[model samples]
Target: MQSPFDEPGRIFSNKRPLEEDYTPDTILCRDEEIDRYSEALQDVIEGFGPNNVFIYGQTGNGKTVVTRVMMDHLQNETHKHDVDLTILEVNCNKHDSIFNVLLELVNQLRDPDDQVKDQGPTKGYLWNTLYDELDRLGGDVLVVLDEVDMLGHDNDKLLYDFPRARKNGDLENARIGVIGISNNHMFKDELDPRVKSTLCESEIFFSPYDATQLSEILDHYAGLVFKDSVLEDGVIPLCAAKAAQEQGDAREALDLLETAGNIARKENADTVTEDHVERASDRVEEQRVLTIVRDQLTSQMKLALLATTFLNIDESAEPRAKNIYQVYKNICKTCGYEPRSKRRLNDFLDSIRLYGLLERDERNLGRAGGRSYIHTLEVEPELVFEGLEYDSDGDDSVLNQAGIVPSPEDTDQYSLESFGA
Candidate 1:
């Protein structure tokens, strides 16, 4: 008997290019963004100083990759001109607070053996240590904060202070600049006015890639990762079109293609075909929806979503805001939790809509003098049920108490009428 790991995979010649962290040497379909990013960093290469840059884009649109490419070019040019440059980077998702961010920066500056512990230090001490490190390095230093929005409104003091550190007497020798990259386009606006002005001296936005752009990018990566003629003619196009229709996310497209290849390899197929792509896409989308519903939403938001899902399954039509609110209140009561105000429930709906989990439409009332919003589940109702069920830890689910189960085949199992809707 031969083990599965005995032979090399036949589908993917190289899988590194499909990895999330992999950065290609050439970035296609982002020439304009690259040019803008280059201009933002040109000041650093010229020896004047680094400019604070703010970049905003949705996930998988190449914001981080473009920044890395630009930084590499900046380093080469600065070296040629003999300009002293130091670059520090951290993802604010892990180090979410001001103190943790400062600590991460301090640790990055220190030698591996001399790192400071996360505990037993005031934020002020950490700031001083960071300033001291900067002054010692004593050149132009660029601090790149990726997912900076994760710091939230309370922890944004670093954004305000980092750019102005030199002039504010925090450091006498080092000139500091900050580059904040966020997936939330509204994050910059939510910052304090003072922080916003200093950190956004230069701003760039990366738009989602259209189908044509995603196809080009997929072709480029396919050429690098797959053996010649291994991909069927329609595989790349199907993957690109599917991703474009959803979020125009290049990462999703790449994941789809990679999963398709893996599926083909598992089946001992010589070429990846459109059928594999379709199956891969379904799997990817289901996982994505589950992750968002389970991990990303708050308890109240989950209740609201559960309400919407129930209505969607029962009525087979989009539920209005009032209908959803009524159902949500009933579910909250069944679960022994207090319901939020109607206004707050609307906010939850909007937030869910922003996540692309729900689709909302406005119905204008010609003679009624007002409009009503209707919402439909953007994902399959069964996926929502599974997410909520897992979130509640299986059989003891709040959904179960509310008479909502994952049986889509029998819609008669539950109804809003039972909830007094």
Candidate 2:
């Protein structure tokens, strides 16, 4: 229904791609990794025993993306050889419980009947249905549990049952291969030795990308993600270098570049420049740190962080444990809440330190010959106060009086001029 010029120009025209839209098939580099991944699954493709692989890396570095691509290829090739193969990818964080995971598998495999989808069967029923479907399919199934470190103790049942399902008479026709992907390298150590032995049949390590590799990877994406003339020289390299130094996550580098481009467009700039990248990097870093803290913190811990910020802002208080506790008590009183005990508050401080928001240094009280720790907020106290509010029902008056409120002209500024002695 389209014109010839429209079709031809569209086909030949440059399509600017977003960094997140990148795919492995369109991935321009990492040939060596692809080869390694292919060879590792060669045995499984030949209809031999299924392979249980443990894949690990820092955060990104192409671990998940590579596995996704290789698995797709593996399934295709195996199917061509008349091998009945099914691949199921589940993110373990959301499906942490074995029951939840089994439910997910059943939901995926089940027909879209209203009864089946809505009023789902019980765990035992689902497990029976799962085995029944697998036996009916009569082939090899590869189950990729991504973020498998989140499996917690609930994973033991599946880890014990699935692999040994055949000998245990749980399944007759289907063979299951589990490929667990995790950022935590110590996850295997926490597993039962028997489960570890089964899951660790083959292990693949994905190393962090160096600056050069990151730039190369970013370069491939820049062409796809930006207008040809939008990116200035050296911008990609700078973004890549910054991300590589911090986490060596290729996905982060890509996200940085894409974010920079978006920022440029927002500012109505002609091109994506180093300044844009720098601002983008700061924004990304701030978001990343805050996200990490938010996930690790509980409501009480967040309240403690706010209390510390209030102490840092109050002119009469020091940022020490005692002073922070007083401010915490005041904040709780103003918000119509009860402050936890000092010991509990100390525990909260420890939690925030573990969350990387505060730094606590232990030193000896010289004359008294006692040990005490000085606590300092690592980031702007204002951000901490604001972030805590996301999970708190604290009065808005508390924020305003403490000067933790953001200003329209300078949302990024957090002055310590109000720091208490």
Candidate 3:
């Protein structure tokens, strides 16, 4: 018997280039963004002091990568001029609150054995400690907060304080600058006016990549990751086109290409073809849908989605709001939980619609009739069942107790009319 690890896969020569955290040696199709970002950081390298920069873009639009590239350039240039500089980066996704953000910064600056504990420290104490450490360092310091929007408005004091530390006398010896990177375009508007003014002194926005740009990016990565002639001519273009049509996401395009390569390797195919890409697209979409359903949706939202999926499978016609509410109530009863009000249920439906799991159409009847909303599941019924079968508690969920299995061909077990809608 041969070990799985013993066999060398012919599809991918190196997979690191396809990973999310992998930084390419050269960035393609982002020259303008790089130039703007370079200008934003010019003061840091020229000894004028650091500038606060706020970068906004959708996911996979090269916001973080461009920041990293610019930071590298800034560091290299600063070294040439013998300038005193310190760079600190904290991902706000994990350290979300001001206290946690401060704690993380202190830990990064401190030795591992002398790091602060997670609890028992007040925000003011943390602030003072952070200021002391910064003052001790005594140079131009740039702090990067990635996923800055995750801090929300509650933790925005860091935004206002870090950029104004020098002017406010919080740090006598050290000068502070902040670089905030966020995926939400509206995050800047939500900040306090003072914080917004200081943090957004220089702003840059990254637009989604078009098909041509995605294709170029994909080709660059594919050439580095795959063996020569392993990819069919159409594979990159198909992946790029599909991703561009959906959201113009370069990350998704790259993932699609990588998944296609893995699929070909699994099948022992010599070359990655368009058929492999089509299958990989379905697989990637299913995984994405499952992740949203399991992680993002609340319990009530899951129930509402399951109710819609049941209707989508059992009824020939799309389910109306009234019909779904009735079925939703029954499911709640079967699960031994109280159902929310019909109005609240509709809100859940709309929320799920926003997640791309469901479709909603508004219709109006003529002659004094009110509006009606028709709902349909955007994904297949099987995916919804799998998504909801396991609750977060690791216990069997509503699907198990209700004995409801998704059978698109068999619609006799449940009916919308049975619920007296």
The number of the candidate with the highest lDDT is 1
lDDT for each residue of candidate 3 in 1-421, tens digit (9 for 90 to 100): 8666535758888988876678888989999988888888888888999999999877788988888887887888999998889999998756756888999999888998999998799989999999999999888999999978767666667898788988988888888889999876767886789889999999998888999999999999988899999999999999999999986888889889988988899888999999999999989998777767775566677778877876777646558798788888987776676888886686567557755788888888556757888887888777777777666567776666666544434445665554443
Residues 93-130, candidate 1, lDDT per residue (tens digit)?
A: 55766888899999999999999998799998999899
Model 2: per-residue Cα lDDT over 213-248, one tens digit each = 898888876665566677889898899899878768
Off by over 4 Å in 1: 1-9, 290-421
Clash pairs detected, candidate 1:
none
The better-scoring model by lDDT among 1 and 2 is 1
State each model's CA lDDT, in order. 0.84, 0.69, 0.82
**What is the alpha-carbon lDDT of model 1 when measured against the actual structure?**
0.84
* Candidate number that wins on lDDT, 1 or 3: 1
Q: By how many angstroms RMSD does model 3 differ from the true structure?
A: 6.6
